[model samples]
Target: MKLKVDYKKCEKAGECYYNHNALFERTDNGFPKILVEDLTTDALRHEAAEAIEVCPTGAITIEE
Candidate 1:
């Protein structure tokens, strides 16, 4: 239910956090960091989906 990131493919574009700051954060190095606990609700999941879609590197995913 949490979000995961594949660092190998991440380019630190800051898109995920930019699209959904409540669920993710931009680290000092520019990588996206998960900020929420669990995406148990539909609204949160939908927001996560939008954030995932904005990832140009396709590095973020749902950790079920």
Candidate 2:
């Protein structure tokens, strides 16, 4: 699986950080930091999905 974050639509709520900091974080100005440029593990994919869920702007997408 693969994950993609749309920086344009990101609202920077940081819910992904609360759920899984390994995959996402907030920038100094308060935007989600795209941590894993390339994710090949199931664990990382799961966390990415979690990030997608909480994004207020629906900025994240997962591809299988």
lDDT tens string, model 2, 2-48? 67778788777777666778877767888767677577987787777
- Model 2: pairs clashing at backbone N, Cα or C within 3 Å: none
Top candidate (TM-score) = 1
lDDT of 2 at 2: 65
Per-residue lDDT of model 1, residues 32-63, tens digit only: 78888589899999988898899998898888
What is the lDDT of every predicted structure here?
0.88, 0.76
lDDT of 2: 0.76
